[model samples]
Target chain A: MTYCVGLLLDAGIVLLSDTRTNAGLDNIATYRKMFLFEEPGERAIGIMTAGSLSITQTTMARLTDAIEEGDSPKSIMHAPTMLQVAEIVGGMLSDVTSEVSAKMERMSQNATASMIVAGQRNGGPMRMFLIYPEGNFIEATADTPFLQIGEHKYGKPILDRVIAPGTSLADAEKAVLLSMDSTLRSNLSVGMPLDFAVIEANSLEISRRRRIEADDEGFSRMSAAWSEALRNAFQQIDPI
Target chain B: MTYCVGLLLDAGIVLLSDTRTNAGLDNIATYRKMFLFEEPGERAIGIMTAGSLSITQTTMARLTDAIEEGDSPKSIMHAPTMLQVAEIVGGMLSDVTSEVSAKMERMSQNATASMIVAGQRNGGPMRMFLIYPEGNFIEATADTPFLQIGEHKYGKPILDRVIAPGTSLADAEKAVLLSMDSTLRSNLSVGMPLDFAVIEANSLEISRRRRIEADDEGFSRMSAAWSEALRNAFQQIDPI
Candidate 1:
């Protein structure tokens, strides 16, 4: 299981993902699930994936290969808008998923993956999408400015309460981290060494990027503070 | 779908469940998910169920019929210990599930249900078990003194942070209610008109029972207070 969240705030887009991947309890491994496509002032796209590692890795490889070939309509780098980039990624993801799922079907295994694509093109509006295994996708709306994939429920209550289109970029980043923190505490399959990215709206570039290691003092302090705050909050509530 | 939680504390057992049932988004109804069986001074057992309503209702009917027949060993009233009562309930549930599932197989429908059983019989220690659809059950231990059924993840983080065998019954009740509140906010399938009960250890009877309606002022105040507390807590956490 994985836990990744993307928030589309008026100020920017915030994306976060954990790197833990496991085939089973005993076969856990660390694998980066965040892919960045950048053209500095032209375009910047961040893709966070969850589900079958094989499918996601293959999809990423294929997307990268397309970009390297250059000028391909299917390449995210050449896509005219954020929505077109999402379509290109979704198309690649769907193709990879079908190819892998067909082979897995013989053994009754699942090879589907879901992804969150967030970014902007120079003249286009910043956008975020949740792409399903079937390649179809839905964009984040003002009423629901955040999208989450994989092991989502444990971290959802907080996001449901805090995130909004009007939220500041800083607050949106904090919300996604705290959401990831809740998931990490409750789910073993989602672990440390998280990838976080912030894209200031219309900048067409990742304004900030971070790789939070397991022993990062900032993350530890934030996590401890959140826990302590929750305990205090719980204690303050009146007993029935 | 449903969300029910049971917490075993040194002082007592706290059980709470939402009363919503839905076949789909368009077809939803309220159905009681909590069942209480008490011989007052002799024993008290509370069963909170989730999953297929047909299987759970049928299992409840069979257990009621068994108890009505009086002297039978399989009857919860005659069970020698809380563990035995769990076994009796588990057996009935498994039987009903299999019967219902076999018939549903023709239509390719799922017919499985899970339950949380908490109780104490005279001369026995208080116990709580999470009974699986297969009839096997696992008791809550001092290390993990809480059990949840149905849409559990949304409500799990708070319980993991606050619940323990050493927690006070008052605090335990608050924890479960807050947990249910989280689930209600995140899941449309788990809704209002909740059933709550408290059983003091060794008393062999429920000490308190409340049906919290949607319009209950106290519950509404608590919910509002909790949401405010969470938002305040989120704000206090340092940004990453």
Candidate 2:
């Protein structure tokens, strides 16, 4: 299980993801799920994946291979728009999933993966999309400016209440973190050493990126504050 | 689909369930998921069900028939302890589920249901059990004094944060209502009007019962207040 959220706000795009991956309870391991592609000032694309690690890692490798073979039309860095980049990634993800799942079918194993692709190119608007395992995708709009994948239910109420297209970059960051915090409390499969990134629209660069460890003071303080605030709010409600 | 919660608190027991049933988005209807049985001063039992309505309704009918026959060993009303009552209900539920599922298998339909049975009889302590479709059940203990069935994740975080064996009946009621409120907001399959009941320890009778409709003013006010409180709490948290 995993939890990843991406927000498309007026100020910028915010993306966050947990690092835990497990085949089973005893086979737990930490693996980075966020990949950043940038030609600073030209383009910056962030991809956060959830589901089968095999499919996602292979898809990432193929995308990286395309970028390494400079001038390839399929490379995310060369895509004309954010939508095109999502299309290319979705195509690659679908191919990889089909290939892997075909082989795993003999053993009755699943090899599906879903991804959130968000980024911007020079002169283009920042856009976010949730790409399904079948290679189809949906872009976020003003009415629904945020997208989440994996263990999403526990973290969705807050986002539904607080997020909007005009929300500030600062507030968007807080919302995703709190959203992640709720998931962390409710699910054991989603664990820390989280990858967080912020991309200011039109800048074509990641403005802020951090790897929050288990002992990170800022995350700890924010989590403690949120818990305290919730308890206080719960206490304040009129009892039946 | 349905969402039902049962809490075993030191002061008493709290049970709440939504009444929505749907085969699909177009086939939505209201059907009660809660059934109360009491011989005031002798015993008080509440059963809240989720999953296949056919299985649950049939199970309920059989239990009722046993009680009506007077002194049947499998009758919930004649069970010696709350645990025994859970066993009787679980056995009936499993038998009904198996019978229905075997027939439905030809049509590729599901016929499984789960239930939460909570109550106490004279000389017995308060007990709450989550009975599975297989006729097996698990009782709630002090460490985890709450049990939820169907669409549970959306309403679970708050319970994890606030519920305990020592939580007052007033607070327990509030917790379960707020929990139901969260599920209602997140899931379309779980809707109003809802069934709520409270049973005080040693009373052997339902202390309170209410049918909260969509137009209920007190419930509406509480829902609005909760949403406002959550938004305020989200705003108070420091930005990452």
RMSD of each: 1.0, 1.0
- Interface DockQ per candidate: 0.85, 0.79
For all candidates in order, the CA lDDT equals: 0.92, 0.93
In the order shown, the chain A TM-scores of the predictions are 0.98, 0.98
For model 1, how does the per-residue alpha-carbon lDDT over B1-240 read when each residue is reduced to its tens digit?
Answer: 899999999999999999999998999999999998888999999999999999999999889988999998879889898888899989999999889988999999888999999999888999999999999999999998999999999999999999988999888888999999999999888999999999998888988999999998888888899999999999898875
lDDT for position A36 in model 2: 90
Which ten contiguous residues of candidate 2 chain A have the minimum total lDDT?
A: A231-240
Docking class of 1: high
List, residue by residue over A8-69, the lDDT tens digit for candidate 2.
99889999999999999999999999999888999999999999999999999999999999
Q: lDDT, candidate 2, residue B122?
A: 96
lDDT of 1 by residue, A1-240 (tens): 899999989999899999999988999999999988889999999999999989999999999999999998889999888889889989999999999989999999888999999998888899999999999999999988999999999999999999888998878878888899999999999998999999998888988899999999999999999999999999999875
Per-model TM values vs. the true structure = 0.99, 0.98
lDDT of 2 at A173: 86
On the 0 to 100 scale, the lDDT of residue A179 in model 2 is 88
Per-residue lDDT tens digits for candidate 2, residues B1-240, read 899999999999999999999987999999999999999999999999999988988999998999999899988999999999999999999899889989999999777999999999999899999999999999999998999999999999899889989999988888899999999999999999999999998899998999999898888888898999998998898875
- Provide the lDDT at A47 for model 2: 98
